[model samples]
Target chain A: MYKVKVYVTLKESVIDPAGAAATKEFKNSDYPEVEQVRVGKYIELTIGDTSKNVEEAVHDMCKNLLVNTEVEDYRFEIEEAAAK
Target chain B: MYKVKVYVTLKESVIDPAGAAATKEFKNSDYPEVEQVRVGKYIELTIGDTSKNVEEAVHDMCKNLLVNTEVEDYRFEIEEAAAK
Candidate 1:
């Protein structure tokens, strides 16, 4: 089995209002050094078998399902899982 | 400046509905090898200065604000930023 982790982050040109709000809240509380904050999505998946080309399948998923290319960028890492 | 990335994931015991839904959808569509799925939060923060102990502060933020210890596990990576 292969364990895959996909990270989807906003593009450099995009503005993250939610992250801005969180930063504002944090700065108001106790963390003033936090200059900028951006929130992204992390996805973890377990591939049941090696039947398919795992990397290619994961890349396809990221490009089509997991990411909004116009505003977000995504990358993934796949590793062999220890048997369970 | 320091660039910090915090990845928050669901604990082993916790059930992830969103991830399950996605996995089911994927399996139904074209990816049958997807066995399990989990969704998590990825936070990117740019710390403005070096006055603070970056590691300590990041850990504190993760413990107190970013992660809910009950159902989520979190980890962070911090690296010095190149002057831009």
Candidate 2:
């Protein structure tokens, strides 16, 4: 089995309103050191099958379902895991 | 500056409707191997000033603003970076 962790994040060129708001909020609060903030999605998957190429399958999943390519960029890491 | 990556995830006992739906969709689609899916928040922050304790500040941020402690678990990592 494979345990995969995927991160889908806004592109640097895309303005992140949520991040901006969070930054403002941080500044207003005690965290003035927080200069920039970017929020993204972290997806974890437990793939039961190991016969297929895990990386290829995960890449396809990201492209097809998890990520919006226009405004977001994504990356993933895979690790072998004991079946659960 | 410091580059901080925070991962906020639902507790194992909590139900994840979105993740369950995604898993169902994957089973119906090409990724039948996907047995389980868990979705979480990936937050990135660039802390400009390094004078204060970065980890302590981040912990406070997560506790006060970034995470809902009741149903979620949060962890963060910090790396020193060239001023940006």
Candidate 3:
């Protein structure tokens, strides 16, 4: 089996309200040192098969469909293991 | 300044459609080894001040507004430095 890890984040230039809120709260509550906050996503997947062909297929899927390349970035890893 | 890291994920029982789709794509593309995909979010924040009171405030902000405790988990660290 293989494991795939994906990370997603907003474009750096984009305004992150959630992050902003966190920053504001931090400052207001006395944590004035907080400079900025950025939020993103992470994904992990376990695959069933352990073969080069299978890994290639999974990579393509992540590039074309699983990730929104326009705004998100992702990376994946593969591992071999006995079926579970 | 302080750094806050937040991780948000679907509850174990919750279904993740995005993860499912990624899995299906992996299998269909010939990467059948992919077993599953679980996606989550991550956040990082940098704070400006380095004081015990400030750290406490930032921690509370993260707990109360930065993260959805029901579906998210978070941790933070504090650092001392000259203002930049």
Best by DockQ: 2
TM-score of 3: 0.66
Q: What is the lDDT of every predicted structure here?
A: 0.88, 0.92, 0.66
**Alpha-carbon deviation at A46 in model 2, angstroms:** 0.7
A1-84, model 3: which lDDT tens digit per residue?
Answer: 655555567778777887787667666754555678787777777766443575567567667767677776666555555666
Candidate 3 local lDDT, B1-84, one digit each (tens): 455555567777777887788667766864555667787777777766454576567567766766677765555555554556
- What is candidate 1's lDDT per residue for A1-84, written digit by digit as tens? 899999999998899998989899788867888888899999998887767788899988888778899999999999998868
Evaluate candidate 3 and give its CAPRI docking class based on DockQ.
medium
* Best TM-score among the predictions, by candidate number: 2
What CAPRI-style quality would you assign to candidate 1? high
lDDT of candidate 2 over B1-84, digit per residue (tens): 899999999999999998999999998998888999999999999999757888898999999999999999999999999884
Instruction: Summarize candidate 1's per-residue lDDT along B16-72 as a digit string, tens digits.
Output: 999989888888878878888899999999888857788999988888888998999
- Candidate 2 chain A — worst ten consecutive residues by lDDT sum? A49-58
Q: Model 2: residues >4 Å from true position, as ranges?
A: none
Candidate with the larger TM-score of 1 and 2: 2
Backbone atom clashes (below 3 Å) for every candidate: 0, 0, 16
